[model samples]
Target: MRPQAAGDLVHLSAPASASLRTRPGLVVHRRRNLSMAPPHVVVRRGLTVTRLEQALVDSWPTLPPAERRAPVIRAVNDWLTTSERLAVALESAPKLVDRGALRTLVARLADGCRSPLEIWGHEHVFTGPGMPAFRRQVPMRLGLRTIYLDMFAERERVNIELDGSTTHGDPRQREIDLRRDALLATIGILVVRFAHRRLVHEIDAVRRETLAILATRRPGVIA
Candidate 1:
């Protein structure tokens, strides 16, 4: 139980035998059995609730198709869960309306994308532009700190970072990001960052910019 934020409802898990009556300020979930392993369900402060991964899967059906990828990616990145667990949860849960789409998203998560924008960029830029395969979540050691780039082309020393509000909003984090960017620049890595809105709405411009950068970074490389 992460500290409950204000206006957060109590998510109570009950047996299937329990009554289905809805109560104010309490969201009840009925389960047939309670044999989940660790990380699926957790007991904190004497309350049992689904873990982040399970909660993301449970809420998959409620979201529109375009909105599903972000939550799943965020859950995997935040909770350190794997695509295998997400696959199993999706298999068992009946709420997933688009199973294939969810599985694709799980695959994207396995590929190192932490948000919907990265997925779109990967699919659009990597494949459509016939660019060489790029690595996702590329970890680099900068002294004692480890920074993960959203996508990296090792040969070209190019890195693409996706900035979402939740992840990069804090002033401290912003300063840290700037320092990291400077360090990468010193090593001849071309770091390109895109905001969430720009990536979603102005993808064509993003694609053009990426292709131009890649072309200049590695002359005659993209065929």
Candidate 2:
């Protein structure tokens, strides 16, 4: 047979060639398409997975080198603005909005706006010039929770049921109302109720009674 070109190597023992082939990664190049990536591998902005991963790794030091407690005041202001809405629109859960914090935030917002008053009506009582008539807000909890009068004022903690004439129209309902008041009283929450006639026809007298109940809780009670 004629001699082969210079690139051709001298024939060696098959065992030697096989041993070299078995060396780690030596045969990898011989296996065509072995280095080709899997289908899940992705490219973005002309960057390959290797390049993207490298970029992310390099940015790691700068990404979390500092700890920051979010600025609550500034966060509220940012949320208040319509322009900033997009910044946090996708952030479904607000970090600062909780029962106590939300109430405090709303109180500040309410103080700045007159519309809140007209919109919520008479029940929407604000802290008067001197009296600390705090707003009623309950802590966020699961399920249908009721806000007792205590949430507003300790004096108002005693539940006072004001019934309409229709309540007395039915004798059975009147008895139920009496029983309800007694039950409430048994619970240690004082119950003083009044008919609609007394409440509407003699509002001043009713007001006096309401004030008296509140007075009992004043700083110096003989108890």
Best model per TM-score: 1
Displacement of the residue 179 alpha carbon in candidate 1, Å = 3.3
C-alpha TM-scores of all predictions? 0.70, 0.33
lDDT of 2: 0.38
Predictions in order: lDDT? 0.75, 0.38
lDDT of 2 by residue, 92-117 (tens): 22432232433333344343221222
TM-score computed on alpha carbons, candidate 1? 0.70
Worst 10 residues of 2 by lDDT: 61-70
Give the Cα RMSD of candidate 2. Answer: 25.3
Candidate 1 per-residue lDDT over residues 1-223, each given as its tens digit: 1334587565565667887656898877787764445655788688666776777776666555666676677667776677878878777776557777887888888787776767877776555744768899988987788888888988778998888858688889889888889999987888888887777788788778877777777855654
Error of 2 at 214 (Å): 1.4
| Model 2 / residue 221 / CA error / Å | 1.5
Over 4 Å off, model 1: 1-41, 62-71, 98-101, 164-178, 195-198, 219-223
